[model samples]
Target: MINWHRLFGLALEDYFTGTRYAVEMEKDVARKRQVLDVVIVRGTGEALVDPCDGLEDLRPHNLLTYKSGQESLDAWAIEELIGHYVNYRKAFAPREPAARFGLYAVTTRRPRALAEQVTLTPVKPGVYRLPVVGRSITLIVLREVEPCPRNALWEIFSFEAAKVAAGAGMYQWRQDDHFPILEEIYRRYREAGIPMSYTFQDFRRDLARETLPELTPEERLRGLPPEDRLRGLPPEDLVRGLRTEGRLRGLSDEDVAQLKDLLERGTSRRQ
Candidate 1:
């Protein structure tokens, strides 16, 4: 079975790298094994370049509860989320204003039972604001969110094949070494019988396209073979920077004769 909770937390960690928020998974709110699914605390650093769909208005402290596709986001889940929020507040910031904290419930699907119990006001597409115990909670339905770059992380957990493909294509990891996490997600999807048309090779190509442009020419060609390094260059460009001896140094007499013949043939064809 897929460890959705842990995977989701790690994804969030990768998503928030270099941002002002710090993500902690399975946070211990009390000594009695009361653990919160995830907690995101505001810290000092660069702000998010592109915030997720339901997380536009982040507070100093945010508590999030996630329900995978296999699980139902029922009334008990919301109650537990609220209970965790209360415990966190009492223990960590009893004197802080309620406005300093935020509550979020992210689910792969809509919480029908929770919706029946309380009103979930539609704040935006796929996002709802629920009022409970005088506090507002943001409910993000991942499957309903529009497929876009900002919502790519949420789409990864949507468990729908199309959305997962879109997310895999659009989402750029903040850190360079998170490909293994993506591989695990793909493996779980396959295990669950989801037909993902987007293969791991597609992901690798997309990742290279996104990251390669930011690197210098030398940096990009660091470990490439000689032929690969000069793969796309025109003949003139291949020898443009080399001096006469530099170009001839590595050529044997037979190789030099073949090179001279090839150059003569090219010149004759052009003429």
Candidate 2:
């Protein structure tokens, strides 16, 4: 699986960099004699990062499981992740409340219906939650997430070596509309000295482009209103507004263009 244990550890270490918790991978559960994919423990480092968006605040401890896109997790998977939480509580956390450890399941595929007793709630577009006992288990659906530069999870799609091999067929959507963020993540991976696993070595040979071309300043300014553009304001802000706020307002591109042209002519005549 392209050394998922190493890849996730490297990525999450960076993701939670500066957080109070330390990121651990392939953690052993001596009770069940099983290994966990990842865990976050408090006091691992200095507290420096604000909480990441769409992710809950880090607790004293957290348990996580990761599945490649093709892997279909059933009720058993849920049971297993919860079991890790149970073990974590029994072993590590004592003075803390029951279920002090958080549980996380990150995958590209939508999980099958969970146990009837488990109530899944939507925390965000790509994040779901099940509060069991006194702790919370979060499900991160990678393919369901929208592209954003601010999302720390871009590493899952962009840089996870296992995904390059295991997820190509099923979770291709992970690469869609995320080229910019992906490039940033890839750069970090390279800078961090994390090597691509042998599983992906053959695949990287045929890899075409590393990143897509981002919109230039000229392109961003192209359709902006003369008043806004000539005001020497940030044209990218206008483009962002057009894409997000304007869409919400139901403003069509044609409508925006006509308004820009009208303003351009008005300003030209006055000059």
Q: Give the winner by lDDT.
A: 1
Give a tens-digit lDDT track for model 1, residues 1-271: 5488989999999998998999999999987988898999999999987688899999999999999998999888989999999899999999999999999999999988888888999988899999988999999999988789999999998999989988888887887778888898998888878888997778888878888999999999999999998888898998898899998998899999999999999999999
Off by over 4 Å in 2: 44-53, 113-119, 133-135, 158-271
lDDT of 1 at 101: 98
Highest TM-score scorer: 1
- The TM-score, computed over Cα atoms with residue i paired to residue i, of candidate 2 is 0.53
Clashes of each: 0, 0
Write the residue-wise lDDT of candidate 2 on 41-146 in tens digits: 8886566443433456556787888775446656677778888776767677756875455677877566765535466788777778877656567877776655
Measured on C-alpha atoms, candidate 1 has an lDDT of 0.91
